[model samples]
Target chain A: MNFNFINLQPYSNPQYFIYLMIALIPIILGLYFGHRFKTYEAIFSIVFLFLIFDGSHWQQGVNLLIWLVYEFILTFAYQYYRHHGKNKTWVFSLAVILAIIPLAAVKYLTAFPDNSIGFVIGFLGISYVTFKTVQVIMEMRDGAIKKVDPVTYARFLLFFPTISSGPIDRYRRFKKDYEKVPTRDAYITDLQYAVRYLFQGFLYKFVIGWFFGTYWLPKITASALVVGNANGGLKLSWWVLAYMYCYSMYLFFDFAGYSLFAVSISYFMGIHTPMNFNKPFISKNIKDFWNRWHMTLSFWFRDYIYMRFSFFAMKKKLFKNRIRLSQVSYFLLFLIQGFWHGLTWYYIVYGIFHASAICINDMWLRFKGKHKKQIPSNKFTEWFAIFLTFNVVCFSFLIFSGFLSQLWFGWK
Target chain B: MDTKQGVLDILNDLTGEDLSDQMDENIFDNGLMDSMASVQMLLSLQEKFDIDVPVSEFKRAEWDTPNKIVAKVESLENE
Candidate 1:
């Protein structure tokens, strides 16, 4: 333990990957030989976690440690409560609310003054880890999670690769992979996918995203600001449009690149954690885009929030019409997701925009279903749908990027 | 010609995707059906069988296939 401690964000740079890939060599070999070296994996998890959570950012690590212990206890307690099979709905609800307190507190702190003490408890990946804990609680309520092995549960939560940003893995899917060693041939296929994803990730995040976010986006934003200044007040122009698209692309490539790395590293460790994006830009509609983009997060929302809420509403007969019920569900889902991003106007608006877009998309789908013959199905129309959806999503991303705040009101 | 076939017939009519051939499929993941379809199908199933399938208690895998759906109905009936 005489090694000099250095901290790095997981998959933040190309050099970090070099170190990680080298470290994973033994684990990979063990997996290839039909065994998962659990002790080594745990040791590395701690070491790598230290690498990320130590140094100047040790606050985050400490906070993460505390939060992990807290959530771990909460899930186990919830599981224990449910063990008697005498679970009340209110108990599960209370557990979920308690589980989310840290994230809610963290998000709320961002609304305070700079020197506010509420900021101290905040940590990187708090939201993601909260999602993981919350899902486990939900699945436990459903009897989907029968057993709670603390060690395996810890592995799922602190899974180093995706502990930061996520292509959120479900407990069942992740546990299945963790519990079994992939056959050599199957692992080779995973390795091939891992390598491909790595190459694609490097190009997307390091190259293209870097080019857009670091190099081009600022230039365009500057140009937009200049145009606004000349126009005698804050007003948008073509340069702002350029910023919109560039920022959108940057968001995609960078985050999707991160997701690819997370999945790639998971594959290297014999877990096929799911993919996050699947050519989202080609989506013909808002719903399709959500299905394809940040898929795990979207699906998480779909299963845990949207569907559950909608069903609850339906049973209560809250909305007379199905469309109204769906619209309200979309609003609640996106609004919560928006607030989750950060406590800001732009983020809130971004969520509302998507919510509204999906409601309209639902209407359009209904209309299209009713008038199948009236609307022509052809290459032109297909491309038009893709083009329209792409622009709409990019515009939403522009708002989500909080650039509009900078444009309309001087960025605080 | 039981509750299973009854569920399948409604699923075949309601789900826009082709579920006739894929009885043992993960109906949701295969992109064959979406949440709306699931909601509609669940409603239909509840009405047809007069069973209480709570959304919270329902796991996707348990009712992912036709056989699983049948098993679920049978379990509920037994209960």
Candidate 2:
């Protein structure tokens, strides 16, 4: 019997976990006994990371190596500069630009056809790894992380469990957990959550996500296009609505399920990587939805992009009124978020759509805040808010799905 | 006069609620602050105490309560 160990993508199927769990047993035992076998853990992580980019994916593996070396140099160099009491804004900005170059190139290259670039220049989880790297660099600039341990930095960047499509753990938080072995009681509780999340993931991803995405989505899409085309101009049909809801549910289940698996595996390893989704559909507003959905990524954007840009703008007196400043910041945050999704028209539109919805939500909130007596506060209104937010979010997901581009232009 | 009351006043200003007695409670968990409010809080800290808390350094767990915020600000002020 021949098993292709090198070809396995992380968490792509149920069988991957069987192999993963088998490998994780040694780690579990080590953690259970309050001994963190660092050297062995490093080796284990390298082997798993190798498994992700080995065989046919070897080019990405090579790219990962090259990427790691430069990032290490850039990070350490910046750390040295910061440690030496250098805090020039331009230097910091230049370092950030250099750090983002590879990711930017990869994002741009993805828009072109395969082989057009002549060689592949990216690895799996490049975005997540870049997120971690950028965070470190920014924190270094802030003097928050003055000392950068090379070994720990490597471990934090390449933590194999959530490498691909991360819940996006912080370097400081991850390093803190990585350096300590959790107490036995704590480890047991982690194990309990691990088991719970793993099964919940199975239910959400394999069962419900399959029912919506695999079973219903294609049929609904086919009917939507057929009926929409027959109705002529703009392709409006009830099937499109069905497609929207189905696709939204599918996106939530599939992604939230994947995030659960990542978080669960992380817990088993005694690192509580943050959760990505938190009943996002039940959100009462777009702002609430962002807080619940893709929380790590959103928080990353909020901290790094939104806060920084807003502060910079405020410092420079770009907007005098605080309300106007925040409104502008929201647009910048979501638009960058959109372009980060891809260099596609649909993705841009999706970003703009959310930005507009959230801006409107902010206006309504501020209005309600001022005229508290005018707007009736009741359970029905709260429920209505949730309902409205859910439908609005689903509509945005439809834009994100590129179904509209397909529905109108017959191309995606 | 102290950093604690300054922090309390800032929290009160941001949340529109009197947080003086709620020093130990988590402002985030209790819905007294949000992402935007947290930024505003940080900006206010910069303005009042001259404690420039970088967004990167502003961990929610560390700054989730008024007492924690005061402590963080004091530490930064000393540094």
Candidate 3:
């Protein structure tokens, strides 16, 4: 028998879902009957995960396995240490650093030319997996997770639906859902949402996202560059504005669509993986946007990074005032977020831009609180807030897109 | 003062609203608390109770209600 090797990126096309749905039928049936077929589910996950890394991408698959082994050892060792009642701060810090080293290496190495590393060292979803591992390690340090079951940890890491990107499910939350089967009625509700999310994902990704990203984005980029070149000096033009909005819309639809698929599939398997996006464009402020948009990632940053930094700073008396402490935290959070996007000037700028925006937003909120009666709160003001936020976020996205870098320095 | 009253006092200070009667209500969902307020609440809790509350360990769902916060504080005290 001859075997054909194929690499199917998750949610790349409608046909991929057809294949996915067919495979999920058994798992869905088991859940509907109030029995979770754990073994079959594992097999299913392996097959799909294999397909993702098989064929030409096998090197990344190898990388994933190696990375998994490293993380497992680090996680279990840290858990073991914590269980022994020896929670040294330096040990925890070392564990956290060890957890992130591979990802940091991948990010750093991948920054250079393709063959610079000689071979690939990171897999798809490496950043997301790092997020999960770091979360587990941190929680262990906090005594939130006292035990690390190897199988459960493995299952959580390799849960295929959100593996590529994420709706970044926590280990404990995923474990809870994985351990129990939803009731028949609840499973039916899950199916309902699964179907709804699947269709909405199709609409957003295939139709709208395609129209903007595939259809309009190229045209707008071309026109923007042309117009900017003609005008010279930072290439200020209406086309740049068009590119900003179009790129923003495309970015939203594509990622939100992909997130919906991840979430929908997760529901089918009876794991209520969180939703990533929730009408982000309607946000009334930059902080609100972070809450609504890429919610899992933003919340991860908020809980793990921003909140932690604020607590540390406050405890150490790093700042004279709470406001200044928070401001510094915001800068740290967004700057790291920028660097995480890539080692690029524009990404850093985009991070700084958001940090500044959020700081300003905080100041505005304080002023508004002080003079609530003077500044009327009404429908008009609410709409105006949204409109202003939308523009600000779009401009940030423009910086994120690195379009200005290309238009000015002919580099992106 | 008891743990419940101490928690209520802190909640009132942070949210600037009387939360004594709304023991079961989700302060976050009701817009009485947010990310910023939550940080401030944690700081105040640390100062008042001298209990360590790591940011990672604070789940929003587990500590959403005033009663839940009271219980959590008591538990931390016991720990």
Model 3 C-alpha lDDT per residue in residues A55-79, reported as the tens digit of each score: 8888888899999999998998888
Q: What docking tier does model 2 reach? A: medium
Q: What is the TM-score of chain A in candidate 3?
A: 0.98
Off by over 4 Å in 3: A1-4, B16-26, B29-32, B50-52, B65-68, B74-79
Rate residue A312 of model 1 by lDDT: 71
What TM-score, to 2 decimals, does candidate 1 have?
A: 0.92
Error of 3 at A57 (Å): 0.6
Error of 2 at A328 (Å): 1.5
lDDT of 1 at A25: 98
Better of 1 and 2 by lDDT: 2
lDDT of 2 by residue, A262-308 (tens): 99999989999999999998999998899899999999998998888
Model 1 misplaced regions, further than 4 Å = A1-4, B12-33, B50-79
| Chain B TM-scores across candidates | 0.79, 0.95, 0.96
Ranking by lDDT: 3, 2, 1
